[model samples]
Target: MYDFEYVKPGSLDAAKSAIAGAEDGKLMAGGMTLIPTLKQRLASPSDVVDLGGLGDLAGIRKDGNSIVIGAMTRHAEVAASADVKAAIPALADLAEGIGDPQVRNRGTIGGSIANNDPAADYPAALVALGATVRTTKRELAAEDFFTGMFETALEDDEIITEVVFPTAEKAAYAKFPNPASRYAIVGVFVAKGGDGVKVAVTGAGPAVFRVAEMETALSGNFSADALQGISVSADDLNSDIHAGADYRAHLVGVMAQRAVKAAG
Candidate 1:
């Protein structure tokens, strides 16, 4: 990794100031993505503002009908949180399925969503559960927050404070993971709540996306049979050595079926 000035700020304001003052600054939540990029010389930030000491950005709480999770909350914490398990077992399950023990111990939800990795798991849950992302600057709906692959609506200096996920009446996640990396080859999250049925897919396309057809079908009958005859076109999905667009598209439906059955 390139030599860089490191600052562990105690407060959000201090972190903001430190980042703003640097020529090229990057926020370090769990260092899951940033550290690897630095080691590979993929990113060369002049300053690394570590948010670890900012205690305010690392907790889980119940807020009315929603579960609010601080951005810095680790995957292991999410997987183990009683509140998370009670409110959204599917979410906890998804967290538990991410990477491995080491990655789960260190990777943060804020880091995961902020990185916006196309194959990341959180985006599917966020979109399916209709969660809201609270940033230092503003709040963005999950749909609006994830703009594209490895991209978000956040400004360069903006920091995610927390994520608010409304409890779903029924929800579940299913994924076909790549054997080596365990990143999702095709993951689907299905939810039925106040917002109605939502089917969000990840790891199959360039970005997490909703399947309107499946959502519509499941809205009438929330079952694996509901997904019958439904199909996802391969036209816009990812195609690589891991899986072809056609296979990924096919897996989308398969995972969605599994998710629906699990949700039931």
Candidate 2:
């Protein structure tokens, strides 16, 4: 990794100030993605503001009907939290299915969502569960947060504080992971909530997206049979050696069906 000035700030304000003062600063949550990029010389930042020292951004709690997770909360913590399991077992299950035990123990939700990796698992859940992302500047709906592949609406200096996920009537996640990396080759998250049904898909395309047709079908039937006649077009999905767009499109249907069944 390239040499860079590192600052572990104890407070959110201090972190923000440190980042703002740098020529080209990057926030480091869990260093899952950033560290790798640095090692490969893919990115070089003038300063790395580590948020690990900020204790406030690391907990799980229930606020009324919603589950609020702090930004620095690790995947393992989310997966093991009694509150998360009781409120949203599917979310806990999704957390448990991340990269691996080591990754889960170190990777933070803020890092995952902020990186906005096309194959990331958290985007599927956030988009499907209709969660709200709270940042240092403002709150953004999940739909508005993720803009495109490896992109988000966050400003350069903005930091995610927490995520708020409303309780779902029924929800589940299913993914066909790339065995070598455990990144989803195609993943689907289905949910029925106050706003009605939502079907968010990840790994198949440049960004996480909702399937309106499947949402409509599932709203009416909420079953695998409801999706029997539906097909997702592969034209816009990712096509690489790992899996062709056509295959990913096919997996979308299969995973969606599995997700619906799991939700039930």
Candidate 3:
């Protein structure tokens, strides 16, 4: 890794100041992705602002009907949180299923959403469960938060503070993962929340996208059978060595069915 100044901020305010004041400073959360990128010389920032010291930025809380997850909270924390399990077990399950124990313990939800890896798992839950991303500057609905691959609505210096996920009637996530990376080749999150039925797809296309057709069908009847008629086209989906667009297209339906069944 290239030489860089490191700052472990004790408070959210300090972390934001460190990021905003520096020329090319980057926030370091779990470092599951960022550290690898730095090692590969993919990103060479002047400073690394570590958020680990900000104890206030970690943990899970129940906010009435919604579950609030702190920005620096790790996947393992989410997976183990009794409040999350009781409220949205599917989301907890999703976190538990993320890249094994080490990755779960190291990866943070804030980091995952900010980075917006195409194959990452959390975005699907965010979108499907109608979660709201609260940041230092403003709150963003998941619908507006994730824009594209490795991108989000956050400005360079902005930092996420909390993620608010509303309770759902039923929800589940299923992913066909790459053996090595444990990234979803095509993951689907299905939810039947009081807000209505929501279906979000990840690990396909350039980013996590909603399957409107499936959502419409599932809305009327939340079942695996409702997903049978719908089929994702291969044209716009991702194509890679582990699985091509065609294969992923098929998995979209299969995974959708699995998610539906799991949600039930």
Those runs of model 1 whose alpha carbons end farther than 4 Å from true positions after fitting are none
Q: Which candidate, 1 or 3, would have the higher lDDT against the true structure?
A: 1
The residue-by-residue lDDT of candidate 2 on 1-264, one tens digit each, is 789999999999999999889999999999998999999999999899999998899999999999999999999999999999999999999999999999999999999999999999999999999999999999999999999999999999999999999999999999999999999999999999999999999999999999999999999999999999799999999999999999999999999999999999
Candidate 3: list runs displaced more than 4 Å: none
lDDT of 3 by residue, 64-157 (tens): 8999999999999999999999999999999998998999989999999999999999999999999999999999999899999888999999
TM-score of each: 0.99, 0.99, 0.98
Compared with the true structure, the alpha-carbon lDDT of candidate 2 equals: 0.96
RMSD of 1: 0.7
Alpha carbon lDDT at 216, candidate 1: 92
lDDT of 1: 0.96
Candidates sorted by TM-score, descending order? Answer: 2, 1, 3
